[model samples]
Target: QHGTPSSPGELAHHATLSFSYLWAGDEWTFTDARGAVTRVRVDPAIHASNGDLLRDLAIAGCGIVMQPEFIVAQELARGRLVPLLADYRTMDLHLHAVYLSRRHLPGK
Candidate 1:
């Protein structure tokens, strides 16, 4: 964790943290400024389903974690965690808020 990598190629040498519930848990995908896509296969030393746990591990310098910005915002701001590969774009996964109409509600 001393020398944080600044490029996608450097990720292979570092340890990774994977989310067990994510569809592409072991695969990290990125898009460069040139619109080139690169997929990296990471063998995580630790796998977990909880984001909080992964954040904790990353904050403790266990390994790099791919987590939502909201989850690690505080730690990152406080310098407890550092953001890497700022130029590269990762997958944009979002949580959608769904609402059901009365007709679609239970036994309508």
Candidate 2:
């Protein structure tokens, strides 16, 4: 496994796997304990739209991947993946659910 990066400045030396389609996923933002934000630009070694593929690539020692915790929970638990840069918080990824209003819509 690629060793943990203690600081944002060290990330440029390692390969990074990305799962972004819109952006190149090159630049990453993180928050520190003092609520300071740091942006690090990593070298994108591989780009895949699928999270699973990124996880697999990470597990195989191809590169570091910044993904949702759920996607790599098992690996982390089994010691297959080790978290890095704990002092900094990665970009918060969110998902929203939108549903139709039953009161305004006709019955299906």
Candidate 3:
């Protein structure tokens, strides 16, 4: 993947391929060091509701995917998938946990 682009402008010269997931929208947005934003609308090569499947496809060299760090952490550590556009930051994803009242919680 020596020809792979590291910047948004260069990426545009290549096919904007991606693997689709239900929660992930059609756009891949990145904010650069100068605070400039780049929004990319991907041409999906595979559409899957499962993140694992998407990650697998990416590992198989199907196409590029924007997956959560936790999901691809092992692959990244093993050098299976290389990080791109390190200088840019992606949008933050917020997660929330819900449970019953504290009174219903078990005592430890």
Question: What RMSD does each model have against the real structure?
Answer: 2.7, 2.6, 3.7
Please report, as a residue range, the 10-residue window in candidate 3 with the lowest summed lDDT.
12-21
The best-first sequence of candidates by TM-score reads: 1, 2, 3
Name the better of 2 and 3 by TM-score. Answer: 2
Best by TM-score: 1
Model 2: colliding residue pairs:
none
Tens digits of lDDT, candidate 3, 1-108 = 438777765654544345454466677789999999998766666667677888888888877777789989999999999998889998786668987789977899
Off by over 4 Å in 2: 1-3, 21-24, 98-108
Per-residue error for 19 in candidate 3, Å, reads 6.1
Better of 1 and 2 by TM-score: 1
lDDT, model 3, position 98: 86
Model 1: per-residue Cα lDDT at residue 8: 77
Cα lDDT computed for each candidate against the true fold: 0.87, 0.86, 0.75
Give TM per candidate. 0.84, 0.84, 0.76
Candidate 2 per-residue C-alpha lDDT over 41-108 given as tens digits, one digit per residue, 9 for 90 to 100: 87789988999999999999999889989999999999999998888888877778998778987778
Q: Sorted by lDDT, highest first, which candidate order results?
A: 1, 2, 3
Q: lDDT (0-100) at residue 87 of candidate 2?
A: 88
